[model samples]
Target chain A: MFDILIRNGKVVDGTGARAFLGDVGITDGRIVAIGPELQQEGRRVVDASGLVIAPGFIDPHTHFDVQLLWDGAAKPALEHGITSIIPGNCSLSLAPLKADDRKTLIGMFQQIEELPPEAFTQAFDWTWEDFAGYRAAIEPALAVNVAPLVGHSVIRLWVMGADAQQRAARPDEIAAMQDLLRECLEAGAVGLSTSFVDVDENARPVPSRFAQFQELDALCAVLGEFGRMLQIVPEFYDTDITIARIDQLAELSLKHRIPTTLSPVFDNRQSPNNVPRTLARIEEQTARGARVWPQMQTRPIDISFSLLRPSLFFARLPGWIKVLRLPVPERMIALRDPATADRLVADVGEDGGERLMGRLVVRGGGEAPDHLVGRTLGEIAAERGEVPARALITLSLENDLSIGFLAANGGHDSTERIGPMLANPLVHIGASDGGAHLTSFSTYGDTGYLFSEFVRKSGALSLELAVRKITSDTAEIWGLKDRGLLKPGFAADVVVFDPQIIARGEERPAFDMPGGGMRYVRDSIGIDTVLVNGEVAWSKGSYSDSATGRVCELT
Target chain B: MALSLQRRFTTPEPDESLESLAARSLPDLPLDVAMEHIRGWNLHIFLMRRPRGLLLGGDVVFIEPPQT
Candidate 1:
């Protein structure tokens, strides 16, 4: 007897083939049959009439490592129909750490992923030190399957201790790292992830960046042993450096015969050819039998921030970031002091922030006045007869620091330009950074946006092609076995949603993290049901208590 | 599928600093004139990223004059 049967739906199977009317039968957590009519008696049956039933989306980039320890479903991601997630990207993970190194890892996560310190300390018991133990801890609680990548930074820290970030590894250290990587791969890790551009909380480059080219080569060789994946974050700002890194990755991929992927390729109107040139290089390497994929996100860059926390807006401005990073009272005092405020305004520009701060729109949030909402900083500054930067500080001080600002469409805003690129066959549709960049933007609904914006609205990609991009294409790129297709013998991970109405919900601040930390989140719209391992995980805007998900193994 | 449609151009060698690079890539102008044109052309880098004229190994370093 089938465990579940989803009947009467348009099945857009993940193979990028055309959709057809069908019913799917599940048994033993696998799809046993898929056809026009499947005569089966089941323990439970869902009437998915008028909904599109397809393979659950696979998100390729995320930082759900710590969150999975506490919220195993990965919350909003599972609700959005993502059954499998690739976490530990950009060289950060939770396992293979000594107790003493907890603070260090916490700082890195805080800096890179914007996770609060209490998330590591207050949420879960820090019991594990190796990849196996970390896997064991989260296995029982997971509702969405995970294909985690062991981080290069964590591996270096495990082997070389504090010296990992100091300099290039010697030969012996490199060998030790290779052994550790092999152990992680065998312990259910799907790949190795490294970063060249990320830094720790102290602004020193992460340990992975300090490693010479030889160290990474040794690690890639280990990945070759198991036919696993290698992911990296290159210096994306500079196209030349990014292309150079692509060449380096191509060499490693050719030598080791392993797939290498990088994120994120942002579309900048200022540098029109940046993304195009990078993709061209990727193609050149692929022609010579090297597999290099560049992952791109569908969402435009919209950053919303308040003085409540350290934000990406203050990233390059060290003085503002330092003050924002301080405790509330100290931060307020620093902002109030004339000397510090003068330095902050000076940092904006010699024009006293006429250029940098003028474009920020007053987004209403956290006790902001209704009058100021939707007004630009430039208008407010003109009213006050002061420069935009000075007006921002003066206004915030008056409001008890409750005002918020938004920098919308910082780049990647032109839909007409981005639509064709996203629809390009060679472009891999991902780099959502889901579960990271918590405060800056909502990464949850890019998959839904892919359908809403690109498929339905813009006509850039057909429904079937868009579904395939996030499912089968992602599976094929990552070498995930038996999960990304709706067919006999494949895992029964499925989503039922209305194609016309699917999109991200409104972005709102949710204070659900440890120590009352807040993250901007968007709920999923138009998704009716999500199933994992043939069991309902989300239905009708609520989650079931089933934890049928396990760590996925790459074959 | 054709991957991209961008024309790739390489930065000239060292001793071929910005002036020499501009003169060679845009040979119609003299050295000093070419340098000024190059500076005016690529303000996004030469003006934005600090140490204004700091050249890296793999920089785009455009040689075209400013767009009017």
Candidate 2:
């Protein structure tokens, strides 16, 4: 008898083929049969009428490394139909780290993830210091499959200690790092991850950024031995530099005979040539039989911030950063001072930040007034007879510096332009940055947004192709074994969703993190059921107690 | 297929100073001229980073100008 049966759904098999009505049978945590009207008995059954059943989505880039310790499902990620996730991207993971280096790594995590300090201290036990120990700690309660990447920074730290961030590794240190990486690969790490552009909480470059090219090359040699992937956060802001990094990745890929990927290849109005030029380089490199995949997110960039803390949204504006970096009491004094306010306003340019701050909507769920919520700063500024910059300061001072504001679609907003790019076979649809950027924006629902905006709304890609992009394509790119198909004997990781309405819900605040830390989250709209390894993990707006997830096997 | 050339760049050797890197990357020019060219071509390193011009081992120091 089948363990479970999903009946009469439109099966989009993650193969870029046409969908057809079918039933799938599951047993022993794997798909046992998939055909028309599976004539079988089952212990349980799922009615998937009028829904689409596809292979579970794979998110290639995430920082769920620490979050996975407490919330094994990665919270709303599994609810949004992401069954298998690749965490430990961007040169930060929570294992192979010495107990002495824990504080240092926590500072880096705080810098990138913005997770509260209590999350580390209050959430779970830190018993593991090596890759295998870390894996063993989280494996028992997992409800979503994980294919983790060993971090280059942590490996450097394991070998070179404090000098990991200070100088280049010596030849002996590099050899030691190779041995450590080999151990991690054997311990079920799917790949290696490094970063070129991340900094610690103190704004110093992270350890991975300090490594010389030879260091990265030596690490890649270890990865080549295992045929694992190499993921990097390149200098994506600059086109010339990103192209250079691509050339470097291609050379490493060809030389080591392994696949490589870079996150966040964005298309922006300011640098319109970034995507096209990068894709051009990728094509040129791929034609030479080098694997250099560029990852791009489907969702437009949206950033939310308030004056209660220093946020990177104000990064380009030096005066705001300076004032915000001050202590809270002093910062309030600076914002209220006429002389300081005048200088700050003047620094925003002659238009007084209208072009930049005008469209920022006053997000509610904070100290913002009922009437001010959902209203744009431009509109409020006109009513108050002040420029947007001055109004922003005044409004925050009035609200005790707790007013939340959102700059929606700040960049990568051109769905009309991005559609074709996403459809480009060479472009890998990922870089969600999920489980990081928790407070800044909702990183939970890029997959849902892909369906709603791109497939249903813009028709950029057909349903079958979009499924293939995030499923089989992602699985094939990362060398995940047997988890991205609907064939018999494949892992029964699947999602049932309404094709016409599957989407991300409105962003809202959730105080669900350890220590009740608040984060912006989006509810899944039309996902009906999500299955991980043949067990119903999320069904009809609820999570199951079944912990059927395991560490993914690599090819 | 032959990949088209990108802007030429190099990473820093261990504890290498800018003057030394300038000497190594642009050997044909005089020291002062090579340093000036290096500064001009790599604004992200020379201008943008805090403690400006503080070189690191992993920096992608551009040796020539932007191709376009």
Candidate 3:
């Protein structure tokens, strides 16, 4: 008898094929059968009428490593139809890290992931020092499948101690690292992740950035043995550097006979040539029989911030970022100083921060005054008889620095320009940064936005094609085995959703983090049910107590 | 299809300083001119970094200005 039979649905099998009326029968956590009608007996039956049944979506790039420990569902992620995730992106993971280095790694997570220090200290116990031990700790509780990438920085730290970030590795040290990487891969690491752009809490470059090209090549050799993936965060701010990285990755892919991916290829209107040039390089690399996937997110770059913490929103504004990085008391003192305030204002140029700060709307549900909450900072500046920068400082000072502001549609917002790019076969739709950027923005709903904005509004990608992009495309690129499709013998990971209304809800603050810390979240909309390995993990806007997800066994 | 060449860049040698990198990467030019051009070509190094121009081993230091 089938354990679960989903009948009378329009099945899009994630092969870029057209949708058709079908029945999917699941037993023993695998899709046992798929056809027009099934004469099945003794099971739960889900009537998926008027709903599209497809393979559960897979997010290729994420920082769900830490969150997976406590919230095994990775919360809003599983509810949004993501059954599989690859965490430990951007050269940071919790495993293969020494106990003494925990504080150091926590500081990096705080800086990069925007996580509170308590997230590491209070959320979970320190249980693992190697990849296998880490897998053991989280696997039993997980409700969403994880394909973790062993971080290069962590491996360096494990092998070279403090010297990892300080200098290049010697030959013996490199050999030791190769051995360690192999051990992690054997222990179920899908691949290795290194970063060129990320930094620790003190603005020191991450350990992965200290490695010479030879060091990376050595690690790639280990990945070659397993035929796994290698993911890197390239210097995406510069077109030439990104292209150079593409060439480097292409060379490694060719030599190693393995796939490699680069995260966060964005489209900036100011530098209109960046993406086109980068994409051209990627196309060239692929044509040479090298696999170099360029990951692009579907959502516009929307950032919410206060002067309370250092935010990447002010990355281009060096002076503001510098002061904002200071400790809270010191930051307050600096903000109050007249010279520092003037310099920060001047950093925005002669328009007195009008062009940048004018359009920022005061975000609600904060310590901001009721009357000022929904108004733009420029409007508030005009009313208060001050420049926008000055008004921002004075208002924050008045409210004890608890006022939040949102810079919506900041960049990469043009759907007309971004639509065709999303539809590009070479472009892998990922880099959601989900479970990272917790306090800064909601990274949970880009998959939903892909459907609502690109497929429905812009008609950039057909329904079946978009499903294929997130499902089979991601699985094939990462070499995930026996998942990302609806066929007999494949893992029974499925999502049933109404095609017309699938979307992401409004961004709101949820005080669900350890120690009651706050983070932004968006609930999923139009998703009817989600199944993880033949068990109903989420159904009709609620979650079930199902711990059926596995650490993905790679191809 | 012929792959068009992008702008040229070089990674720093182990413990290499900006002066050494400039001399090594731009040997035809005078030392001062090479240093100036190297600094001009990579603002992410000379301008954006903390303790600016602290050359790391993996940095992609550009040898020339942005190609026209």
Candidate 4:
């Protein structure tokens, strides 16, 4: 008997092919047959009559490295049809870490990813000092497939200890890093990731950035041996620097013969030419037989933050971050101090933050008055005859600092402009930043956003093409073998959803993290069922106890 | 797409000295002139770097000055 049968659905195979009526048969965790009206007996049947069945989506960039320890399903992501995730991006992972350096890496994660402190200490046990040991720790808990990349910073830490962040590596140290990277690849790491942009909690650059270019090249040589991928987070905000990074990646790609990717490539309306400029370089590189993929997110930037935490929303406002990072009583004292308040007000810019803090709407709660709940800070400030920054501070202080604010559409929101760019063959759709940035924004549902916004709304990509981009295209890029397809003998990871209704739910706070910390999340709108490796993991809007996930084998 | 205007560039050769690399990358220019131009173009190495101008094995050292 067939293990499972998904019948009578519009099967959009993750190959950009036209959607057609078909039934998929799964046995022993692989797609055994797929054709029209298959007559097959099954232990369980999923009646996917009007839904679209496609390969489970693969998110190439994420930081589920920490979250996966506690929540194996990478919650809300699995519910959103992300069957496979490639974590350990941006030079951070939990493995290859010495017990002594765990505090250092934890601080880095807290700083870069904005995860709360208890996420590391309160959630799970930290054992194992090697790649294989780390894998063994989380392998059994995962309900979604993982193809983890070993981080360069951790590798450096493993090799050089604290000096990994101090200076250039000597030749002996370089050779040791290469050997360690090879060991990680041998232990099933998909590749290596480094960062030129991230800094640890101390505002020092991450260990990878401290490495000279020669050091990176040496590590890439190890990656070259396995033909593994190389991922980097470049200086994405600057056009010149980003292009320089692209050129660097192209050179590495050519020299090492490896696939390389840079994440979180954003397009702002202010510079419509920016992405085009970047993509043109990517094309130039590809023409010369170099693989350089730029990862872009589908959703616009929306930052949800409150005065209660040190959020990335206030990252630019060092004064605000300083005040928020303090103990509550000290924070309250500083906010109430007249001299500090004046300086903080002055720090908002000469116009008193009309440009930056003008559109901030006061979200009423805790100590906020009902009248100011939906009003802009500008309006309230003008009513009170105070600068917007001052007004924001005074009001928050009066209300016990319980007010929340949202900075919506910060950038990457130009649908009319981004549609064609997202549809471009060279542009890879990714950079959801899932499972990190807790309380900052929701990184879930980028795939659904691609369908709802790009496919149904903008007509930039058809349903088939959009699915292909996230599923097969991502698999092909990452060299994930036996996944991202539904052909016979391929892993039977699949999702059934109503394309018309598939979308991201409204962002809301979820108190699911350790220490009861809140994270911003969006519920999946139309995903009905998700199957990983032939077993139904999520069905009819709820998750099953079945843990069919495993560490995926890369080609 | 903007082209990389400065065509004369080479990766550093095995901990090459800055002065040597400057001369090798800009063979036509006088030693001092090439060295000055190299110093101006590579503040990331000469100015901001911890050990200024300590060239590595994989650096893309540009010989020509700015194009724009």
Candidate 5:
């Protein structure tokens, strides 16, 4: 008897093939059979009529490293049909650390990913040091399959100790790093992830940046031994540097004979040639038989923040960042001080932040007035006869510092421009930044947005092609086996969704973090059910207490 | 299957200072002149990143002048 049967549904199969009416049979967590009018008795049957049954989405870039220890399903990620996640991207992970290094690593995570401090202290036990120990800690609690990448910064920290951040490694330290990378590869890490652009809490470049080219080459050689993948976050601001990094990655890929990818190739209207030029480089590398996939997110860049915490929106403005990073009393004092306010206003530019902070829409949060909810700060500031920066501060102070603001469509907004780039065969559709920018934006709904905007609305890609992009394409890029397809003998990780209505729900604040912190989350709109390894992980707008997920082993 | 086309460039030689490397790569120019041109050409590395002009093995040190 089959364990479960998904009956009478349109199966897309994650192969970019034509969809057909079919029934999929599952047994012992594998899709045993898939065809029309399948005759099999099942312990449970899912009525997927009028829904599209496709392979479960594989989110390639996420930072669910710490969150998966507490919320195994990765919360709304699983609910939004992401069954397999590749965490530990951009040179940060939660393993291969000494107990003394916990505070340091936590600070990196807090600074780079914007995770609250209580996320580390208040939830779950940090009992792991090596990759195997880290895997063991989260193995039993996983509801979404994880194919983790061992971070390069952590590996450097494990080997060179304090010197990892100070300077380039010695020859012996490089050898030690190679050995540690090999150990991590053997212990179920799918690849190695590094960064050229991330900074720690003190605003210093992360340890991975300190490693010279030779050190990275040594690590990639170890990855080559297992034919694994390598992921990096390049200096994405400058196109020339990013292209240089791409060339470097291409060289490593060619030398090591392993696949490599980089995230967040954003489309900027300012530098229109940036993405095209980078894509041109990628194309050249691909022509040279080097696999260099550039991962791009489907959603527009919309940042929402309140004065309650230090947000990425204010990252460049040092005074605002310092004030927001402080405790409530300190932040209030800084905001109230006229001298400090004047300095902050000066920092906002000569127009008194009219150009930068003028268009920010006041998103009514706790205690904010209803009348000012949807109005721009420019409009409100003019009424008060105050500069936008000063007005923003005054408004927040009036609301007990709980009023939220949204900076929408900063870039990556033009559909006509971004559609063709997304449709490019070389562009890997990912970089959701899930579980990291928890408070800044809803990272869980990018996949949904891809379907809603690209597939259904703009017709940039057909539904089948879009499914393949997130499923098989992502799985192939990350080297995840058996989880991205819905065929016989494959893992029955699947999602049933309405094609017409599939989209991200409203972005709202949810105070569910380890600390009493709040994050903007958008619920999945049209996902009817999600299955991981043939078990129903989510169904009917709720979740099942099933922990069927396991650590993915890369051969 | 059809493939895409793109430009190809090389990095500077090992242990070569930016000036000499630029002189060798851009041979028609003088050493100091070549170094100034190189710095101007690659502001991303020469100015933006710290420890300015610290070239790596894999850096894309451009040899040509600005196209536009």
Candidate 6:
């Protein structure tokens, strides 16, 4: 007898093949049979008639490293049918870290990932110093499988302590880092994740940026020995730098014989050549037998922020960032002070932010004035006969920074362009930043958006292709063996959903984080059941208490 | 798959200075000329980074500007 059976479903099978009517049998956490009719009885039989049964989606890029300690399913993430997630991205993981350096690593996570301090302070107890201990902490509560990438910054921190961020590593330090990376991999880390663009809370470069190519090469030697993946956050804002990073990644991949991935190659209207050029380089490198995958998201860049806290919009403005980083009382004083306000407004450039922040709509949240909710700052400033920057400052100060502003349509909004780009065989559909970027925007429901926006609307990809892109192709790209297929003997990670009604739910504030540290989440729509290793983790709009997930082994 | 255009850049060696990297990547030119080219092409390093011109390991130093 089987553990469970899914009957009379249109199984798409995650192979980009045509859907077939079949019954899938699951026994002992693996798919035992898939045929038109299975003879074996099951303890649980789900009649998934009229629904599409496909492999559970794999989110290849995420920051569930810390969140997993408290919420193992990464919430709403599992509900979206994400059976497996690759966390520890962008050079900030939680393990292989000293207990004393906990504060420093937490600060780095808060800075780079925009996670709240309360999450670290109030959530689950931090009981780990090594990778194995960190793994032990999160393994029990997981309803979703995890293949964590040990961060390069944390690895450097473990090897060099505070000096890791200050300068390049010595030879002995490099050897030690290699040994540490090997240890992490042996402890079941799927890959190594690093960054070239992110800065710490102090705005200094992260420890990984301090590394010389030789140090990374030494680390890659260890990765080669394990045949694991190497992930990097490149200088994606610059075209030349991105291609340079791609070439560098390709060189590493070719030399080390390991797969390499660079994330968040955004398609910006300002630089039309950016993604195209980057993708072109990716193709060139891939043709040379170098496995370099570029990860791109499906959603447009929509940023929501308020003067109550800092935003990535002020990242280029060092002065604004400094002022915003101050305590509330100090920040209020700085904004009100005439001298400081004058320099800050001047910092918005010659047009006085009319060209930059002029079109920012007052997205209503908090104590925003009712009349100002839908209006742009440009109109308000013009009506007040003041420059946009000064008006923004005065208005925020008057409102006590309670008025939320939205910089919508930031970039990568074009469906026509991104559709074909996403359909490219080499492009990996990820970089959702799902568990990170809490206040910025909702990263959940990207897989749903893949269906609503691209599959159903744009017609760029068929349902089969879209399903395969997020499932089999992702698992193959990340080398997750025995998953991403409905074939017999494969691990039964599956989803049943109504294809037409499948959509990303409306983005809304969810006060579910520790200490009311709010994150925007979208509830899954049209998803029926999600199974992790043949156990129903999410079904009928609610999660099951069964913690059936585990640390997945990479091939 | 070949690109119509791509920028020329160099990854630095271990313990290499900006001058040494420039010399190695742009050996076709004189030492001073190559160093100038290296600095000119990589303003992100010479201008943007704090402790400007301090080339760390893993620094992607460009040797020339975009051809286009």
Report the lDDT tens digits of candidate 1 across residue range A1-555. Answer: 689988999999999899999898999889999988788877898888888999999999999999999998998999888999999999998877777888889999999988889888898898999999999999999999999999999999988889887666778988999999999999989899999767788876677876767778899999999989999998788776677678778889999999999899889898898888887788788988889999989998886777877887777888888988999888889999999999999888788777777899886545667777778899999998988988888888888777888887888877888888887777888899989887767789999888888999899898999999999899889988888999899999999998879998877777888888878788999898999988999998999999989899676
Regions of candidate 2 where Cα sits further than 4 Å from its true position: A305-358, A364-375, A378-391
lDDT of 2 by residue, A447-486 (tens): 9999999999999999999999999999999998998889
Per-residue accuracy of model 6 over A1-555 as CA lDDT, tens digit each = 889989999888999999889889999899989988888888999888998889999999999887888887889899998999999999889989999898899889889888998888888888889999999999999999999999999999998999998888999999999999999999999999999988888878889998988888899999999889999999887888988898888989999999999998879777898888888888889888899999999888887778888887888898999999999999999999999999999999999999889998876535668788778999999999989999899989889988888887678999999999999999999999989988767889999989988999999988999999999999888889888988888999999998888988976667788988777788999899999999999999989897989899778
* True-vs-predicted CA distance for residue A425, candidate 2, Å: 1.4
User: Whose lDDT is higher: candidate 3's or candidate 6's?
Assistant: 3
For each candidate, the alpha-carbon lDDT, in order, equals: 0.84, 0.91, 0.91, 0.86, 0.87, 0.88
User: Number of the top candidate by DockQ?
Assistant: 2
**Residue pairs whose backbone atoms clash in candidate 6:** A211-B57, A212-B57, A212-B58, A213-B58
Per-residue lDDT over B1-68 for candidate 3, one digit per residue giving the tens place of the 0 to 100 score: 66786788899888888889889999999999999999999998899988698777778888877774
Candidates in descending TM-score order: 2, 3, 6, 5, 4, 1
The candidate, 2 or 6, that scores higher on DockQ is 2
Kindly give the stretch of ten consecutive residues in candidate 1 chain A with the minimal lDDT sum.
A363-372
The DockQ assigned to candidate 1 is 0.06
lDDT of 2 at A172: 96
> How well does candidate 5 score on lDDT at residue B9?
43
- The regions of model 5 sitting more than 4 angstroms off are A303-359, A364-404, B1-39, B45-68
Stretch of 10 with least lDDT, candidate 6 chain A? A361-370
C-alpha lDDT of candidate 5 relative to the true structure: 0.87
Better model by TM-score: candidate 3 vs candidate 4: 3
| RMSD to true structure for each model, in Å | 7.2, 3.0, 3.9, 5.0, 4.9, 4.7
